[model samples]
Target: MFPKAHQYVNIHAHRLAISQDEWVLTNLFAGDDFPGANETAYYSTGLHPWHIKDADSEQLIKKVELAAENLKVLAIGETGLDKLIQTPLDLQLQVFGAQVEIAERRGLAVIIHAVRSYNELIEFAKVHQPAAAMIIHGFNGSFQIAEDLMKAGYYLSFGHRLLISDKLKDVVTHIPAEKIFLETDESEHGIRELYKVVSELRNISLESLKVMIGENVKQVLRIR
Candidate 1:
C-alpha cells in the first residue's frame, strides 16, 4: 500500500524537509545531480526554462525521462514560461511542451512556474490538453486569472507570495478547497506558517485545511 498523507504537504520546495511531519515534494531542476540512493523525499523533475540557454536541453530532457522512472519522482515540472527572462518564448514553449508530454505519458502531475505568461499557458493547455494535473506554483495572479485557469482545469498552489500579496490572499479565500495547494517554493518562509495564513483567510480550522490539502495531493496528483 502507498503511504498515508502527512500533516503538511509542501507541493513545491527546493530544500529537503526540516521536519518529518512535512511531506515535501522537492523540485529537481534538470542538469542537477539526482539525490543519493538514501534520500527519502518525493521530487518533481524537469528542464527549467531559465537554464535552457546554458545547458544541453535535449540531454537534460533525457535525464528527466530517466528520472521519471523512479517512483519518488511524482511530477514533471517547475517547468513553464517566464516572460521576465531573456529565453525566447518560442524556445520556452518547445521545452515546456516536451516536459508536459513526459508528464502525460507517465501519468504524473505537473508543477508549473509561470510568470506573466498565463494567457499563453492557458492557450497551450487548450491545444495540448495534457491529462496530468497542471498546478501553477507560487500563484500571485488576480481572481479573474485564477478563475480562468481553473475553468481551463488547472490547480493553483500558493507559497511565500501568500504572506504579502493582498491580491493573492483574496484569490486563496475563494479558490475551491479541492483545487488549491500550498508550498514553500525556494522561499525562506515555512510551509506551516503559510498553512496558518491560508486557514485564517479561508476561515477554516488549521487541521481541516491540512486534511483537505492532503486529500487533494492524493486525489488530484494521484499520489496513491
Candidate 2:
C-alpha cells in the first residue's frame, strides 16, 4: 500500500526556506546557477519564458536535458507560454516544446507557467500528446479553460490566488480532487495557510485535502 499523504506539498517555490518536514518542489532556471550543493530539496528545472533572453537557446536545452537525468529532479518546468512577458510567442513555444519533449523522454512530469495563451497550449498538447503528466501552475483562468485542460488530461495547480479569487474557489470546489493541486508559487503565504483556505473552499477537512493532494503529487512525480 502507498504511504498516506501527511505533509504540505509546495509544487513551485522560488526559495527553499520552507519547513524541513513539508514536501517541496523548488524551481531551478536552466540558464541560472544550480541550487546550493548541500540543499536536499527536490527540484524542477526548465527555461522560464521570462529568462530566455539571458540564455543561449541551444545550451539551455542541453542543460535541461542533462538536469532531467538527475534523480533529485521531479519535474521539468516552470516553463511555458507567457503572453504578457516580452519574449516572443514563437520563441516561447520552441523552448516550451523542447522541454516538454525532454520531460516525456525522461519520464518526468512538467509544471507549466501559462499566461493568456491557453488556446495555443491546448492545441500544442493535442498535437504532441506528451506522455508525461503536465500541470499548469498558478492557474487563474476561466472555468471553461480549466474544464478544457482537465478534459485534455492536464492537471491544474492553484496557488495563493485561491485566497482572494472567488472564481478560483468555485473552480476548486467543482473540479475533481484527482485533477487538482495547490502551491505557494513565490507567495508570502505559507503552504499551511493555503491548505487551510483550500480545505475551507472545498468543504473538506485539512487532512483529507492533504491526502488528496499528496496522492496527486506522488502520481505526478512518479514517487514510490
Candidate 3:
C-alpha cells in the first residue's frame, strides 16, 4: 500500500513481504531508476508501466535489460494493458509486449496490470507464453475470469478490494494456497491487516499463511 493512502507500513506477524515493505514501496514505480544494487540494503525490482511515458522508450528498454541482469531484479513488470487510462492504448501495448518479451528472455517473473482489457491481455499472454509466472495484481474481475487465468497457471494477487467483496471471498475460497497472494498494491491497508482477513478466509493461521506466501514469492521470483 502507498503512504498517501494508509500512510505507513505497519509491520506485524505478516511475513508475506519477502523483502522489506518500504523497499517494495518506494521503488515500486522507480522504473528504470530502480536499483540494480543497494548500499543500504538490497531491494527487489518490479517493472511498472506508469513511468514508461517519462523516459525514452528505446533507452528504457536497454535499461530494463541491464536491470534484468541484476539478481535483485526479480519481477518483469507491473506492466500490462489498461484501457481506462488516458495513455494511448497502442503505446501501452507496445511497452507491455516489449517487457513481456524481455521477461521471457530473462527468466524473471512478472507483476501484471490488467484494467478493463482482459481480452487483450489474455491474447498477449497467448503469444508471449512467458516463462515467468505472472501474478495479476488487484484482481477484481468476475469469478469466471479469475478461473480462466487460474487455469492458465497464473498466480493471483489480492489487495484492498478484498476488504469489501464477498464475491471475491467466494472466488478466493476456491483458489489453492500455492496460487494465492495478498498485496497492498496502491492501497492503504496494511499487509498485516490483509493477513488477518486472508488467514480467516483461508482457514489457516496467519503465520502459516505468511510462510506459504513467502514460498510462493520465492518460487515465482526465482530468488535464491
Candidate 4:
C-alpha cells in the first residue's frame, strides 16, 4: 500500500526547504503533480519562527494575502511565539498576528508554531476568536498545557517527537479522540509508524485508528 493516502488539509513549506517532491509523489492533497514542476501543493503553508527573520516584512504580508486570496492557501501558517530565539518576540507576534488576521479575513485555518508562548497565543486566540480552527502543530508541551488547550477547543497535530513523549501520552489520553491526529511533519518516519503509536494509545486496532485519523484529518483541514 503506497502511502495509503488520506485526505490532508495542507502541507506547509517549513518541512519542505526544497521542492515539495514527496507529497508531490504521494498525491495526498489534490490533483496530479507534474514530475518536476511545483508539486500539486497541499492546502497549507508551514512557516516556522526562524524563516520569517530574513523575509521582507511587506513582501511577506503581501505574499500571505495573495496566498489567502488566489492560491488555495487554506492555512495562514505555522506561526506563533517562541522564547529561546534571538528574533524579537514582539516582532514575531506582529508577524503572527498579521497572518492570523489574513486567515481570519479569508476564513482559513491556521497551523500554529507555538513554543513556550502558549498562554500568550491562547490569549490572542481568545480575544480574536478567529473562525478558522487553530492547530497547535508539532506540540511538545506538558500534559496540563495540552489539557488547557484542548479545553479551550483547539486542535493538536502530533509528529515524531510527540510520539516519544510520556507526558504527551498522558495528555493525549485525555484528548478527545476526534481532536487527535498523527503526522510525520517532514520526519523520515512513515505515517504508519505514527498510526501505530496512535492505535496503541487509543486502544484500537491499527485499521480502526487509521479510519478515525483519516476522518479527523479531513474534518480539521476541511478536506473532502
Candidate 5:
C-alpha cells in the first residue's frame, strides 16, 4: 500500500509520469528494459504477445520468473492471448500458461491482456484454476463475455475506452463493484477523470467508487 491516503490508483499504466503521490502500477514487458527507479510505483512485467515472435522463449520465461520475485512487482502480466497479433495461438497459450504458473508460485495477481480470445482464456482459466487473482486489463468485451469471466472468478479492468464506448459503459454499470477496476492503460486520461466517469455510470460517488476499487486492488495484490 502507498503512504498517501485517498489517491486515485492506476491499476495498469505503461509510461510512468510524475504524480502528486498517486499510486500507479506500471507495466513492463518481459524482453524489454525495466523502468527507472526514480518514481514511486508498483509494477507488473511479463511477455506481451506482440513481442513473442522475436523474443527468446526460454529467456523470457526466466525473466518473468525473476521479476515476479521482486517486492515492488505486484502482478505477473500484461500477458495473454491476442488473436489479432501474428504470434501463433499455440505459442501464446504456452507462454501465458508459463507466466500463470509463475504467478501462482509467487502468489502474485496477474494482469492479462486479452484481445479477441476470451473463450480461449476462459477455458485456460478453468483448466488451470489459478489460486492467484487474475485481472483482464483493458477489457471491452461483450456483457456475456464479461459475465463468463466474472463467473469464473476473474476481475475485469476498464480503461479510457469506457468514456467513449456505449457498449463498455453499459457493461461497466452492471459489473459487481467487487469484481471491477479502472485503469489508464497507456491512455492520456487522468485516473481521477476515469474514476469520475465510472462513478457516474455506476450511480455512486467518486469516493465510494475509489474506496471499492482500492479495496479490490489491495485484496487482489495482497497489499497490507
Candidate 6:
C-alpha cells in the first residue's frame, strides 16, 4: 500500500480540505451532511458520545449502520467512552458497543475518541476482542497507556496535543511506524506540519513517514 506516495494521509479530520495531494478521511457525525463522493475524500460516520445528550440513540445507530454500506465510509467512529462529560457511562458504552458491532461486522476500522477512560476502553477491547482495528484518535495519554493499547493491537493517532506535549512526543518516537497515525482532528495545524514534527522526532524522512502512515491507513481500513 506504500505507493512511493508523496501525499499525506490524514486518518481523521473534522474539516474537509481541497488539496489534491492529500488523502483526508473526513469525519461526519450521525446528523451531519454527507458530502458527495469524491476521489480524494473518504469518510467515517458515527454518533459521538458528546453530542448524544438529546439524540435518538437507536435512530443514530441505524444511521451509522446505513453509512457503513457506503464504499467511501471506511470507518465506524470518532466514537468511544468519555468520563469528563455528563453522558452516563452506561449509555456511552451502549452506544459505543453498537458502533463497534457495525464496524466489526462490516470489516472496517473504528476511530475512537477517548477522554479519561483509556482503561475502560482497554477492558472493553479485552472483553469484546473486536476484529476491527481500534484507533485512538487525538491521543495525548501517557506512554504506559500508549504501550498498553499498542500491545492490545490498537493504533494511536496524534494531533495538536503532540505539538505541545513533550510526553506525547516521546510516545510518538517510541511508537512503531505501522501503529502510528497523524491527524488534524479539529486542530488548526496542517497535517503536513504534524508529519514534519513526527518525522523529525522519529529521525526519518518526510516521505518515509508519508509512506508509513499510508500503509497504516491501508491496514486499518482494509484498503487494497
Assess the local accuracy of residue 103 in candidate 3 as a C-alpha lDDT between 0 and 100. Answer: 74
State the weakest 10-residue window (summed lDDT) of model 1.
1-10
Cα lDDT tens digits for candidate 2, 1-224? 12246778788888774665477788888976665434567789998888786358778888989888777777898899999988789989998998999999888999999899888888998988889899999999889999999877799998999889999988988999998887888899888888898888789998898899888877888642
Candidate 3 vs candidate 6: which has greater lDDT? 6
The parts of candidate 4 lying over 4 Å away from their true place are: 1-39
What TM-score would you give candidate 5 relative to the actual structure? 0.93
**What is the TM-score (0 to 1) of candidate 4?**
0.78
lDDT (CA) per prediction: 0.87, 0.84, 0.65, 0.62, 0.85, 0.86
How well does model 4 score by local distance difference test?
A: 0.62
Better of 3 and 6 by TM-score: 6
TM-score of 2: 0.93
| lDDT at residue 121 of model 1 (Cα atoms) | 86
Worst 10 residues of 5 by lDDT: 32-41
Top model number, lDDT:
1
In model 1, the runs with Cα more than 4 Å from the true position are 1-6, 36-38
Q: Each model's TM-score, in the order given?
A: 0.94, 0.93, 0.80, 0.78, 0.93, 0.94
Q: Which parts of model 6 are misplaced by more than 4 Å?
A: 1-4, 36-40
lDDT of 6 at 63: 83
